[model samples]
Target: MSLWKNRNFLLLLGGQGVSEFGSSITYVAMPLVALTVLDASSFEVGVLTAMSSLAFLLISLPAGVVVDRSARKKLMLWSNVGRAALVGVVPLLAALDALEMVHLYVVAFFVGVLTVLFEIAYQSFVPSVVTKDQLVDANGKLSTTQSLSVVLGPPLGGGLVALMGATRVMAVDALSYLVSVVSLLLLPMREEPPAKTAGFSWDAVRRETAEGLSFVFGHPVLRKVVACTATSNFFGAMYFALEMVFFVKELNAGPLLIGLAISAGGAGGVLGGLTARRVSTRVGSARMIWVSVLGLGWTGVLVPLAGPGWGFALIAVGLFGFSLSAVLYNTAQVSYRQAVCPPELLGRVNASVRWVVWGTLPVGALVAGWLATSLGVRETLLVAGAGGWLAGLWVYFSPIRGMRDVPTTEPVTA
Candidate 1:
């Protein structure tokens, strides 16, 4: 049966679609709120961005273990509820004229922590909901909606910020989370908990965490993919750290143009998602991973080349290419991971991969702040673009470069 006709899959997509829309709004609105409302400096913006992803570094390992042991649906529900409550605080404070940068920072961090929990569980849950043959199609459909939200949300967010205020725009995000919670509640299947084992202890967690790490690093292709993704994320964070600042100060853009510029990238993501299955079929799934990056990611340089008026279009073009390649790469690689790992360890392995790859984001944001302060925004962006493109080289030199397809057999965990 087509995933479109699958009731459970449709429910999952509906919930996630709304959630992604909300997140995309926050993605553009949060920094604008800090920059325009609180009058935060470039360094402060970087810190704010760093705080959002830092939770992945701090707790993703443990989150994987928890997902493996508990009911993924329950974890997802709790995560959505927590994030909704946390985002709601922003609008409440704003209404009272009590909003502050510190408040945003706190909200961003805690929301990030919940996001880590939700995402790890979400990835692990997908395989259970669909057959192995449906993995690529399932991910492509999911990515398409996520990309579409990015395409539409940023422009709407910008308009909302202009018409109302950035703080109030967060209210929409909070409402969206409630929608996701309701969707999860309506799903027909209940996930059974993992079999009981010895009583939980710090020692057990430590061993399990190590086991996950070993499984990822022990696999030759996974380690290279991790390296490539980490490098891209590290530099991608730097590019994004200065992206809005560049639009405002360098290109002299207003809120609407800023939103539109960001949306261009989302447009690219939409194309990537829609084409991922076709690309995988023609290029070979494993080959599609590196091909996407090496062929398209270098266009990221168009951003730094952008100027005022007509030249400013270059930023959109650059963002489009980068996002397109990123979505393509992610779809292929994530499906690859899902295919190769043991079902029992999927949660841990996914978490382990996220831990290493996403860990670079906060560090990159911090570095971007420092680099922007020292080198200026445009120069820092140049560095980010060049470094991010170079990351593809890691995979190009690995065994995946020679393969037509990745091995589907379960890997023997080290």
Candidate 2:
């Protein structure tokens, strides 16, 4: 049962592939725009990054309610359109010399808002397009596409930035959304609607949000995973928020070099993803989680040690390790979550988990910015590295560490 043969799944794969590629380009372009064009400091970049995740914290639960109650295909389609239009505004304003830090922040926030809905809908939608047996393979393939984007995007984005400017590179991302929109339009699958609610009210919102929280907190393994990931994201934000600063300001690397290094590191993710299921199956998915998480954190320390030409190479290795470990851990965990959770609760459960895990990103970004300003780039990153390693401790002590694999027979919540 190769997913490639599944016409509907292929459409999803194609759409996400193109969209992720565009988004990856912006990953490099956005920071460069702020740094090279606007002269934004590390703190500002941190704030910008944090703002992007703030919507996850604010709207995730509500978005989950919508996803559970509404047609996911429609939700995903309109969200794509919304994000496409929003991203286009950046380049347009930049060309007119109207772009500012505030514009970037606002755009990031609103885009985040749209992204939350799209994410919840997409995750909920995927299961309907494929059989239960295909979840791991499906998720792995998706991760592989993301890795490919990481490999292709940074280099492409760097070239675009080198030629025109970082601000102009966003147009490509805008177009990528349309590609996704078309794929959605092509899909012939019908989503099953949830039971109709009596009416939307503040009480319903609270109850739904609470139910998601209760499920996660009640589950031992999921709770640990959420805590560990949230903690890591908090510290990882500090490291990532100022990563470009370290490369350009400290290492004296150019945009092309930055892209190359990122791409080089992405190669590890590609490898990790291609082999994710194989490795997880061999080693046991549960054990692999802690192993990968610890490896991600410890190896991340190598980046701060980077100095110059050769130093960039060292940093690339660190990035490679981080990406590799992340792919392995994500493939295992995401598949586990998808498999064990009841389909009926998918939207709320996923949204609630994201709200807790991704919610920490804003705080992390803000803290990273403040730390970089007050302590120093290397010092802040060093602290982040330490914090990253510490995140695994929560899961290490959890029931998950003793398990072998994710079970499909019963909900983990039980």
Candidate 3:
């Protein structure tokens, strides 16, 4: 069955696309808002970012439990509404000429909390709307949309910010969340059954969390996938933390060049996401994942070497996007995980895996910051690139490399 033939999936995708594009806008607008309008110090900008991520770390597990016990659609709707309300404050404050860095930080924190809830619900809901066979395709399609938003979002966001001013541009983001809420309400899927243990208890939650962790760690394929992904994220975070410094100092790039280089990667990601399914079918999922890792790892290697010219940097960034392995890896891994996990365990399992995978980001960011301060920007990037490449070896040497096809039945425990 063609992916487009599924009405509910289309709605979900459309709604999410709107919301993600808005998020893309905020990605640019927020820093600019803090930096230019509020005159936020570098430390304050860093604090705002750290606070937002801290919300994700703090809220993900509890949000998983709530998602498991609630109607997934309702969770999505309310989360969108909540995010809309949180983001709206920026514009309101701007209108009053009362916007402050503290206000932005608080709003960012609130939005971050809502995003965590939405993401937990969103990941858990995918399996319910699409068939097992369609899982990879669905994820691929979603990735494509997300990549498109990344490609379009920043520039569109910059334009909106430029035309309407930063505070007013946030209204576009708020509207997207409202659109998402409406689309979610229109989805036709049956409500998921509540968790068997409905009442919240610390012991029960802890046990559920433990079970999710065990499932991921206990499975041979999942274990290797998580290890490789987590390591890659750590090194990738380092590269990102140092990217601006590398661009300014090493490449002697200006804002226009930086924007062009970043946009090229987004374009590559869109192309890669679109081709994920075809590539997986031709090369096999496991091999495709290995290829993606290598591609991504090499992007890290190539960036620092791209030199001072805008042309060289643009090519390097585009190749960097093209080389991303996560689009395929996620498409395959999400399908594999959803198929193997029991229905009741889906939320926690998804959350557990994310907690481990994304949990490394903050540490990586901090380490990169420290390293950049001590080792210099170019040297830091080189370390990140080399480390990312070495991390790919986890997939290369593991049993995951031998799995030629996704299993149709429950994965056997090793």
Best by TM-score: 1
State how far residue 290 of model 1 sits from its true place (Å): 0.5
- Tens digits of per-residue lDDT for model 2, 35-103: 998999888999889988999989998888888888889899999999999999999999899999999
Give the Cα-based TM-score of candidate 3 against the true structure.
0.90
lDDT of 2 at 80: 92
Stretches off by above 4 angstroms in model 2 are 410-412
What local distance difference test score does each model get? 0.91, 0.86, 0.74
> Which one wins by lDDT: 1 or 2?
1
TM-score of each prediction: 0.98, 0.97, 0.90
Model 3 Cα lDDT, one tens digit per residue, 172-227: 89999999999998887787468654568988788777777788888877788788
lDDT of 1 by residue, 184-302 (tens): 99999977667425567888888888888899999888899999999999999998888888887778898888889889999999999999889988998899989999999998988
Give, for candidate 2, the lowest lDDT window spanning 10 residues.
405-414
Ranking by TM-score: 1, 2, 3
Which residues of candidate 3, in runs, are more than 4 Å off? 39-44, 242-258, 306-319, 411-414
Q: Which ten residues in a row have the lowest lDDT in candidate 3?
A: 314-323
> Pairs clashing in candidate 1?
none
- With candidate 3 superimposed using the best TM-score fit, by how many Å does residue 119's alpha carbon deviate from the native? 1.3
The TM-score of candidate 2 is: 0.97
